[model samples]
Target: MKNCSNFTNDVVYSIIISFISVSCIYGQIPVENDTIEDIEDFDIIDMESTLVEEKKDSISWVSDVFSAMRLGIQYGFTYKAEKPDKIMNNRFSFRLEYSKSFLEYLSVHIDTKMFTFLKNDHRIRDEEDIVALEGRTREAYLQTSFNKTSIKAGIQIVVWGESDYAIVTNEIGRLDYREPLSLNMDDLRIGQPMLTIDQYSSFGYWSAFFVPYSEFNEQPRKGTGYYYDPFDGKVEYLKEKQKGNFSEYGLRWRKTFGKSDISIMAASLIDNQYALRMVNPDLITKSKQRFFMTGVTFNRAINNLLVKGEVAIKSEKAYNDASFQIVKKNALDASLGVDYSPNSTFTLSIEAVNYHIMDWSDQIQGIPRNNYIALLALSKQLMKNNLSLSWASMYNGPYTNFFNVLSASYNWNDHITLNFDALIPIVDDARSGFYPYRDQKQVAFRVLYQL
Candidate 1:
């Protein structure tokens, strides 16, 4: 605690001052308003009219196009918690995004990021992969609107759950696990190629998605710092599927009742998570399995507490047995969460999750029979949300294990911010879920400047 407290104080002071200085300089630059014109008075109605005119003249669906740009730079350092060698987790990252609405029916958005690690870069393979540039599409997509129907096409990140993190009903896209024990849950998602169509009506909204291309989530290679890799310098690969099908599709129906948001969704697609199938002399391989998934989610507020829940059923799940044979099973998972905002700056949330298999096989020793997990999250904002702190913990019932995260964020201004995060785990010495890297405690910090 002493070390962490000292690190937090030092980094917060230096980063806040430096970031605010830069933001002030940037904001002081003389930049005139884009929609400037001769107006009679500063009345609210006149200002609204001016904004409407600006949208009508320049951008059809948006007020301004140049305000779509977002840029940021961040740096962090991490490593194994126990006896570790030299520094292996030093990383630098950059991000950029631009979006615009060109016509009444069409709009385009593009986002991308790059990563550079200074030393002991586990993701790097030889010289080519060093300082890799990833998330190129981040979310490059095009949208069109016609009547009550809208369509979005191209590579995009599609999330379909009401949960804050550890999503249960979200089964459309893949997850990126290169950086494990991360504080930002959204950063863990990776986009896929899909075309979505939505039609709105008084009853509700009906949405459909077509996902043709199929690929599993990326994993750490043999040389990566991720504990999953055996570190034999051999690649961790996935076995080829018998055939690639282009008919994967999903459907979602959502509606609002009073103050409750309810949604039901279904999808038939190849699952992104893979299970170890066979082992070769030089290569470790996994296999992907197709699944039919359906779920219902809801959110509502009563008094000062907000309640959220989702239940998902999977028709097929791939796993391994002691005999090394891949077993397919049906699974059901559900989560219920409640959040209470006792005051303006503090909030507390409690969530319960349960998972069960419809049919259990004695041969299946690798998979847990059932699970009862509880998650508690607390967050507070100070200085009018300019300074914030969040702490969350997840307890695994069967294994008696815990996963905890504590993070602090300081907004130097509208454009610059600093973040510090610590990941701590409590588990038995024997292997359990999240057993690997259980002792690899991590503390990471990043400063971002964006507009």
Candidate 2:
């Protein structure tokens, strides 16, 4: 299986290179001028002037396309260590992406990634193998005029809302949840294979997506985890069941008025489910469960002060024996924040979040308490956009604990970049039963390239 996956990956890379080579050889030679002959034929008194402006716009558009396709590469090293236990690790990663337009109304984009890592160093007897294959498709179907309306399908990213540091329904960030310790990707939002319609006018933009449920199953689960209850001495072991199907429908509307922008999104996850089976055969029969989430965001820039916020509510219906369980869990998560930028090079931001479990009723005696988190961050750009530094502190109120993070990034060019991130635990009075590693201090670095 590994060999086959690698072989397929190599083939895709070769195709990407071939396509870029052909495009470079036959691509149109951009023209520099500001007159459209057809427009000059019009009878209007100012026809010649209007035609020149239109021609300039056409020339600039072609210039932008070629610049966007320039090759770039990034490479970096990341190291993380937790004291006492000697949890030392290192990782290396690389990425390549290309973008070009076949015509004025059609464009294409492709991205490929590679990651490798060494876990626990020599402290552990065996080395861990870590790698991932990721690819993206964008602008496969597009057509537009001055109004900027277009249609797109295939794997493409859809970005909406105005929250700065946090995203509510970012599927690409979902991968980070699977590896909580890894450095976050900047474009953490990725495109699933779906059909999208976008329309833009003087007011703003409106977009909608029609994604089929079947395409989401491209990734498979390797195993399952067991959940245990110490207070009641109960254990629930879940096994992977047959993959389920679900479709996501989304709509977003945004408008910019003066210095402020307002946007809203409505999305639904239909027929979502996870495979589940209890350790005890007599407990209950297996069945599919459904879950859904809804979110909204707003942002405004008032002079030196910029503010943004988002709120989301998620709910899932209980199935099998879960319905009979004494304590069910549903959640509502929200965040509000503001940033003050005294200058173009420096900014300060403060944000607060609440993760409230709606099922936390007094009648449910053993349930975990809701959580509140607050964060403050300051950032500075230096060396003419080559270097950036940021510091952040977060307090998780429910546990009466705090965490601090210091991070920096250096962009050598459009292709190569480097990043450094560190996490420090200032307070660790978290709920006793949870793993202490969640509150441990660690640091890591990463480098990336595009070619």
Candidate 3:
């Protein structure tokens, strides 16, 4: 193994410094107390009472500060169903979320995540071989509002659609697809640096955002369980093309009327997911394409039922043909979702989504001409709402590929939580789509502590 002694030492020191700094900043504030006195000392007792009152005031301020800051520590373990002795992942993570207000109309927010590996795995390469430490600044932004207008700048995550199961119009931000079945919606989002402005008028609400440089999706690393390699790890992969250093800009208009809300959006951006193009027989590389997209979304609440829908059209979307050449074509995406909730404890959601390549041809190898997907989800709260259980499934009609998740979460106390999940992916049509992830069935357990 190549020597990484210096790098390892630096990582350890950085972790120690970070932990100490956080502890000193938010763990507790020390207050000095006077010496205790005997019962005969009445004057000292009075002074002690005064000091106690002052301490109480100081403690109140500390509590207020604590309320604005939150820290979450989590440890997660995943076991492969096919091989009990092999571990898929054993990791620990720390997350911090904070919000503070200065002037009356100005505020700042931050969210960060740090992770360290406790087990050696093939997912990470040699440089990050053992005890790999990774960090991400999910969001860090400053926001200010004046009258009916608000502006924000910094790294941020923005969702721009109404569909929960389908990303019909929510393509503005990059996403993490490393653990698609295990991670939640919020966890999959990746923040991007951007400037945004919003204005409220009598007619509607208008919003705009500009990203100086956009980022692509974070795909699973090579040698991971979910990573896809068409050549079965036999080829030398080349560097991807046009992956970054591009701008993204978008506009949106939204309004709420009675029980209904509607939004219209448009953007010019690069696709976060890349398409593979064959450079040679032994070399395959990825490429990102730019496109213009426009969409509309709406939702209506009627008593115990909610209806949502979205429609989007992309101009000159890129894909790979059967000959392994990049091709651009127009595409249309649409989704309709319905949610039924008779009470606060139980809910059911169903959605149908479609992606159609306009002027379809048989030469497209990456996607079908008319791809259809369906989603079903059910969730319930139990044990006085301290425990939650959910089941969700997504099925692709054309390729007979599907994924299922069964999860449960229990709040052990105010600051601790336990979670368990079973993730299963089924691929029946080997000729239609990539099935490299079909054998990744696993069960995961996690413990979270929040302050």
In the range 1-451, model 1's lDDT, one tens digit per residue, is 6467557655755675556455544544433662212121233345446555653564443335557777788776665556563445677788878877776789988887887776466665554554654444468889998899989998888778877766688878787777766645688877778899999999998989998777667666556677474444565566655666635788999999988999999999787877666575555566667889999999998988999999999987887787566788999999999999988899999988888877887888756678788989999999988999999998886767898999999999888899888888887845466778667677767788775
Candidate 3, superposed: residue stretches over 4 Å from native: 1-64, 83-85, 127-129, 239-245, 431-434
- Which ten contiguous residues of candidate 1 have the minimum total lDDT? 34-43
Segments in model 2 whose C-alpha atoms lie over 4 Å from true places: 1-76, 84-89, 118-148, 167-173, 182-190, 202-204, 214-245, 270-289, 292-294, 315-331, 362-369, 411-416, 426-436, 449-451
Question: CA lDDT of 222 in candidate 3?
Answer: 77
Ranking by lDDT: 3, 1, 2
Model 1 clash pairs?
A: none
Candidate-wise lDDT, in order: 0.76, 0.57, 0.83
Give the per-residue lDDT of model 2 (tens digit) for 330-366. Answer: 6677888999999999999998777677756555332
Question: Which predicted model would earn the best lDDT?
Answer: 3
Q: Estimate TM-scores for all models.
A: 0.80, 0.66, 0.84
Best by TM-score: 3
Flag the better candidate by TM-score, 1 or 2: 1
lDDT of 3 by residue, 1-451 (tens): 1146446644765675556455544554444563223222444445456655665676677677778999999999888786434677789999999998877999999999998876554355553566778898999999999999999999999889887767789999888887666426677888989999999999999999999977888888876656776687888767675545578899999999999999999999888977678888888887667899999999999999999999999999988787899888999999999999999999999999999999888888858898898999999999999999999998886888888999999999999999999988888788545366677788889999998
